[model samples]
Target: MLFTYPIAATADNWVSTTLLELLKNAVEYLQNAQEPDGFQESVPEEYQAEFARGTKFPDLYAAFVDQCRLLNDQQRDLVLKALAGQNGFPGLFAANTPCPNITVTLQAVNQATRSLFEYAFGKLSDLKTPGSVDTVRARYHQLVHSHIASGCCPFCGLEILEAPDPDLVDPDLDHYLAISKYPFAGANLRNLTAMGTTCNRSYKGAKDILLNELNQKVDCIDPYGDQLITISLAGTVLLPGGGQGPAWVLSFDPDALSQNWRRIFKLETRLQANVLEKQYQTWLESCVKYAQKNGIDISLKEGAIEAVRKFRDTCEYETFPAIARLKTNFFELVEAELNDPQDGDRMHNFVAAVQAA
Candidate 1:
């Protein structure tokens, strides 16, 4: 996935205003209701009665208060820091200190915040309407769209259209950390990413990218961080019993988190023959056309090399990355053939076919 640009801090940004406001409100509203032991039993009579009524508001408030009471000053600050987009609290556990119950507090906060956010901004389901405005969601959407020049889903590298009609929905805002599993991160702006509907819903539903085979928690690459996992086209291989001639495969560096991302997202499998062939064909046609127009011999190799480099550079910003990487790998293979005397005929036949097509 392409790295997402970090959201700049501004006075009017949602994190500085809406999120902080909600958090402060939550703390204040629940303050009087919180007992020394962090239970509602010793609270005022009205609050006790409200809790006894079994309403969600009182329950959520109690959970928030209880979690806060359990945390030390430092831990609480960590949560605040995370909320402010300065750090990632849950990801901290992947490193040195393990805060197991932090998730509990975060979950409570997420549940309460979602209810409060929806109350203020209207229901999330109704966001498709042109008139509907959720400040938080809107800001996140704008941040993503503005940052990603390719205008494609970072995960799948598929084109994400900005509909001319305001009523039409854009890409889905995927919670990088699933809200169901990591509720505390639910409202964290850094955890939200804009992705295509298929990548967000179909392939990556509720799966934890932060865990390993042993179910132990590990840190997933933060798409907004300075450090990002790089992806490259590994090689092309012929399927065992295939109608398609060859398919390109992808490979990542030795980083475990990157590997986990590939496995969880099924990157290699998703970009198989059917998905990449069109892109490969396009690259080939472009190269052939360039050679013919320039009156350059396709067999001389310089035109082919130059064409591939130009296409790869342009694809880096203009096309879907999966297709772009496919082009890179395809040209590399062609270059390898050109360099080998025995493979010259194979390369010539390939170029001839591309020209004919």
Candidate 2:
């Protein structure tokens, strides 16, 4: 499940371009490292098959793959040897420090993977041709957009569009099984559906047990594939003393428990704290901007105004303008402190703070 805000495809130009270049470089770099032995000697055979045979650039790909795996204690020695190469940096100038090698490799792999999606979904019009022999590549492209537009939360089938950053939230059609590793005919995209960012983040790096369980659970519906419902705000109820007005509530079908639910839950909690929190904060800014651009009524407090002014005054002007244009509802809700004169007590307050004034 990957939640995303919708920026016009064009709005993502820089990110898209940089990622594509990175992927191309990675591919080219890996391709150049192929040895006479047919394998890169660095990357394992299983991994290399994901890309085309002639396109294998063992050295570069191995270095990059190793770096990402390093954090999780994955295979590293093999990756390093591939990156080190016979002369080291055969194409680029040789350097003693391996940081460049690692960095280049990571950037390449990350960009390449992203580019695969980009091209698959037609982000880079020039790279639309299918690269692999996957029979359903065309269907894959169509399904990506359909799944995204479908709005079903990938995890647990909860409706998230009504929750927040609806546009930024992206739906993912994920494999219930690890098709790459477990290629049973049933392990195809048929077991996929739309998922939210929170779900995906929580489910991140859960390949072994979760994948297996998902495969087992696959049935005819694939709720997301069928598009049974659209997530929307059902109702709002006023609270006493205007405290947190109309607590927004959402409803969705109960998510089926996977055998790895415990692990997924643990991962989700961590992702909520780390990845989703950051994404929420970032999306808040975008929502505010979108509101501002559309001429919606919004308000902000003095502190927020000051921060915006300071950010605008000191930083590069180009970036701040976008921040200045966020929606009113997008303002972060922070409580303020108020004194009860009669009781001589203090209470929290609601402060409307603009993420980007």
Candidate 3:
């Protein structure tokens, strides 16, 4: 993202305005800054408008107006910075591309709406009994969500059909605040994802845990948040023998991270098939030599080929650590080959060197 100028402050005097009006103004500005090709430009002006409507104002109307003013300035600065286009936005909240601006805008709107509702409800809660706090909180939550169904899901990154699924029931809104602290992701519509209620309970707030296990800082990929394509199935694996089976691996692409050694693993598939073919050819040559030296009565080549085939065909995720260690050792051996100067034969100069000697 880029910025042409800093966000300028607004005047102290404020006016009364409805939340609808605030949103209307924000939409208009966004529409104006939108490119002909449909890409949006950052505009901090909307934030200024929101800040002008802060709760400290004398009455509800005055507060909303001031909040809008702050929102206006903030939105304008965001626009200018985003337009400069230097800082690449993270590809979260969508499958293949970044929707930073869209998500940010939604977050802004969500936050503003939440603040307004909280102010209204918190004031009411202050007059009630202590036991009613939970009830009031629930009502406030309901009120917040009342405006949510009208929104869109920011988590899935793209529009999803309103179909009932166990994964999507009682969807809770989520936002990828690691990128931008926008509230747009908190609405059930924008952040709603369907999961079994039980799964949701288990996976709720597991983002931090997953991050730690990953051992690297990678952005989440959501239609509106982050991109995480691979998930561990260590706990999901089950067997009929009352014990866990081998760990199963799942990914949008099985071949993903073939180059990233840190997350690489092994399984029986086409790549392994190819590797097996090469390994068996080498084993065939090795076995032939071994039989010649020992004068073996049996067909050692056949046995060696069979062993290689079995190793390749039955390779599973559990065997990855050992296989990968071997791979690493082989890599080191190759590095040694390249670094050594004693092996003229290895560099294809043996014919001339032998004649000269």
Candidate 4:
């Protein structure tokens, strides 16, 4: 991730809490098989009518109830272990860590445990209760606008996250934890975050942060966490024997996080293709113009070096029309190229081009 997402009073665990409460009720409903009553009351109040047997909406919980009655002793135990276990979906997502994944599968009870939460997760929109997805989204809008950089994705500052408004379409709430492959965090606000369309769907789609493709255990990052990772340009790598064009090198700090992040989102490759490769020379031109406007003569290598550093300092925060980290690092690259005598005045000639324009 590029920067940490701010968890405000707005980004509550309302959806998550509601899901867990339903799961808890499910655990008890299965345990007291002596009488299979009170199953209707276990459902969230807003969607209770829908869950009732002869309702306009389908009785989604009816199958679960029937399955619970037919549970063998071992299956009943599986329900308890999965829903009631300390390290179950509730606990693992509550902490939002990748290690110590919930080992108990919901299939332990032939998916009798799955219906309750999944059904309720869908109904969070109709919830008049304070915890509706609408209430959360409204709050998220406020929190995002106030706390995070405007139109910036906390995952990667490169993409644009449209400013959400009530009348217009909403942003995509990306699940930090892969709820599709792993169970539990589907509706949890803790697991949810707003990301760019490309970031959410294209790159970070359903890739389990907790487990790699080989099913190896990996570390996870909290979507609403405070830990910030650094994306820096280490330097440029030139092609051997010289005519193919220089290759860019990006460095991400706190290597462990970088490895998993890069693996999940293909962060380095995306930045190289989308931002660096396409924008490098254009960005250099902007930097030159910015420095020239500020009365710094960028024609000289010394002046160009000063321009790079000064422009970098201005990009410390992600503001409109500029990716803070990208500009900062690109300038760092410019400064590096300015200092390197081997490139035969690569950036110098680039600066000369800007001056001519």
RMSD of each: 7.7, 18.2, 19.2, 4.4
Off by over 4 Å in 3: 1-21, 24-64, 70-76, 79-113, 116-180, 188-190, 206-357
Sort order, TM-score high to low: 4, 1, 2, 3
TM-score of 4: 0.79
lDDT (Cα, tens digit) per residue for candidate 2, span 85-195: 311211211122221222243454334333233233332222222343322323343344443544444343334422223254334434343323222111123333334
* Reference-based TM-score of each model: 0.67, 0.28, 0.28, 0.79
lDDT, candidates in the order shown: 0.55, 0.32, 0.31, 0.61
* Deviation from truth (RMSD, Å), model 3: 19.2
Stretches of candidate 2 above 4 Å error? 1-135, 150-175, 179-183, 186-189, 192-267, 274-276, 279-348, 352-357
Q: List the residue pairs that clash in candidate 4.
A: none
Q: How many clashes show up in model 4?
A: 0
Query: 1-357 in candidate 3: lDDT tens per residue?
Result: 000101111011111122333344544454465312111122134334343334432243333333444455557555333322212323332223332343346354434444543453333322222324333223333433343342222221112223333354334332223223332222212232332222234333334211324444333323223232322222222121344322222223223322121222122332234333234334334433543454442233333333333333333222233232223332233223323465422422321222233
Candidate 1 TM-score, C-alpha based? 0.67
Could you say which candidate leads in lDDT? 4
Weakest lDDT window of 10 consecutive positions for candidate 4: 93-102
Summing lDDT over every window of 10 consecutive residues in candidate 2, give the lowest-scoring window: 327-336
TM-score of structure candidate 2: 0.28
